[model samples]
Target: MPLSEFDIIARYFAQATPGREDVVLGIGDDAALIDPPAGQQLVVAIDTLVAGVHFPLETDPYDIGWKALAVNLSDLAAMGAQPAWLTLALTLEHNDDDWLAAFSRGLADLAGEYGIQLVGGDTTRGPLTVTVQVAGYLPPGQALTRKGATPGDEIWVSGTLGDAALGLRIAQGQLQADDSVKATLCRRLNRPEPRLALGIALRDVASSCIDISDGLLADLGHLCAAADCGASLHCADLPLSSAARELMSADSGLGDLPLTGGDDYELCFTAAASRHGAIQSLATQLDCPLSCIGLVEAENDIHCHDPDGQIRNISGHGYRHFNESN
Candidate 1:
């Protein structure tokens, strides 16, 4: 017999991760009762993943589960919050016990690593979709925002960019690579690491911050808009993985992926130039790559400066849901 909705929840979703004291009541409750940490602000974020919109249809169930929660966690990380609780609403076309087991394991593994508890959620029969909501905590008045950047601030991004876009190409059969390179790129697309530690460390350091979920240039455009300023990115200074560099070297057109490709999930932030040393120290301490790619400018436009001193104005934005072109 196929599993019923409640049975599925009990066998797969419930107790996926260890219990937490703050979770007064977890799965099986009508609604989760959470005790928020004292004297801290609450940060909540939600994201929905459809069968083929957020990820490819043929993608593994395990990856779907991980990515669903990871994307929501990325939002909390961008706000410089410490993740605590999560709830999932899962929709399925049909019940498959093996698929549920794999998906639950994937979700549980990441939640366990971060000490986050799955409190409560719902399951229903419908088209395949996953919606996850995560709640986090932050010290009073310490949350990072995209509005504090100044004209003279320097721009920094964590980790290399564009790998996920390349991974998508590989998955879609538009691009090909050797086995090792293929695995690396695909992993990046399927499993993005939220820069949680970096976000927390940056609360006092970054003048403003945002995550690079959309393309780097597009999200940076948002930061600029929030601060009512402009930016100049030095193309030569962009951080790229060896795989990306190798691929782009063969096809110069691929260069735009790092700038306009979404799904990097790294943090893009701005800080005063004087904080260079401090930022560098943080990079070393955290063992995460931090690249100074640009500078905030007084001009109200986004410009890219090539190594040869030529300037190109950029007017394009990142991925949009209703964009017929996307």
Candidate 2:
């Protein structure tokens, strides 16, 4: 007998959903019931992943499941929220029991790690697609936003950049990575860590914050726009993973990968110059490298300067949904 929707949920997702105190009612309910903590704000974010668009059609089901949630978590992290619960909407062409099991395992594993509960979701027969909506909590006034930046504030980014972009190139056959660096690059592309802890720690310290879903230049542009300011980025100051550096060393043309590529889920933030020491200490505590790549300006545009102080032309404005069609 073909498994029905209710059967699939019971066999796979029901047991996978974690228990949460704040969740009054979870999976199997018509709708989830959540009780937000008093005085804390609820932060919610949603992201959709379509096969062959956000990820390759041939990508592993487990990776797809993990990434589908990770990306939404990244958004909540940007707002300095503690992940609490999530709802998933899965669209599939066929109900392969094995594939569902692996994907559920991946999703459950990440959810377990973050103490997030799967509350509710929908299942439908369609093209392969996954949409995850996540909710988190943060103190009343501490949720970070992109509008708090000020002129003269310093800009910093967490973790390294460009590896995922390079990995995508390698996957597309547009570029090749040596075998030595292939695994690391591909892992970065497949499994991005949401900087949830770092975001929370920076809640009161950072003047403004955003996650690097779009490339640095593009995402930074958003930050700038929200703050009604411009920015000056030092190209050489961009923190590049060893793998990305090695790949770029061989192909100078790939230098813009870090600036223009997307999928590196790091946090980019601004803070007053006085917080330099404090920021450094936070980095040490988190064990996540932080780079002071630029400064916020009063203007409303973003400019990149090479090591010698010459302005460089930006090739692309990050990934746009309709770019390929146009």
Candidate 3:
């Protein structure tokens, strides 16, 4: 006998993550009741992942579950919010007990790590899709945004770029790598770490901030547009993982991936040049790599510069949903 919708919810998701004090009502309720922290502002974000569109059709259920929640958390992180609650709406082609168990486990593990509770959501039968909504809190008037950047502000990014894009290529058989490299890249594509701590620490230090979901160029372009400014990126300063560098050394054409690749999930932010020491200290304390790759410019155009300071024309503006070229 197959499990009913209510049965499935009770068994697989009702107690997936531990309860939170802020959650006055959780899974069994028609709608969750949350008590926001005193004097704090609420931040909510939602993302949808379709099996064939957001991830490969053959991807593991566990990874799909993890990535779905992780992507939404990344949005909250970008806003310098402390995650509090999550709501999941799962759509499955059919019920599979094993698949449900693994998926719930994946979602619960990450939620527990972040001290977030599963609140309320819905389940339905349809094409494989996962939608996750996360709510977080931030001190009133202290959230980071993308509009405060100004000319001469330094541009920075957390961690390396292009690994996820490389991973996608490897997954689709468009690229090849040794076993170790393959695992490293593919793990990045499947399991991305949201930089929540860094985002929180940057509250007053960063003038503007955004995460690198789309490729650096495209996302940075959005940031620039928000601030009504432009930027100049130093090609020599772009960070790359050892795996990406090694692969690029073998195939020079692959060098462009870091500039145009998406799914890095790291934060791209801007701060005054005067805050360099403070930002460096924060990086050391967190032990996370933060690279200053460029400077916001008064000219309203994004430009790329080679090592010797010559202008170079790079193609593409990262991933676009309905651009038709992707």
lDDT, candidates in the order shown: 0.91, 0.91, 0.92
Shift of residue 13 alpha carbon in model 3, Å: 0.9
Candidate 2, residues 1-326, lDDT tens digits: the string is 87888888888888796798988888887998999889988899999999989998888888888999999999998999999999999898989998999899889989999999999899999999999999999988889998899999999999998988998888878887778798888888988999999999998899999999879988999999998999999999999988998999999899898998899999999999999999999999999899999999998899899999999997887887878721
lDDT of 3 by residue, 1-80 (tens): 99988998999999889888988989887899989999999999999998888899998888888899899988888899
lDDT of 1 by residue, 1-326 (tens): 88899999889988788789998888886898888989999999999999888899999899888888888888888899999999999999999888998899889988988999999899999999999999999999999988989999999999999999999999999998888888988888998998999999999999999999889988999999999999999988999999888888988778778888988999999999999999999999999999999999988888889899899644456788888877
lDDT of 1 at 227: 91
Q: Which is superior by TM-score, 2 or 3?
A: 3
Q: Candidate 1's C-alpha lDDT?
A: 0.91
Q: Candidate 1 has which clashing residue pairs, if any?
A: none
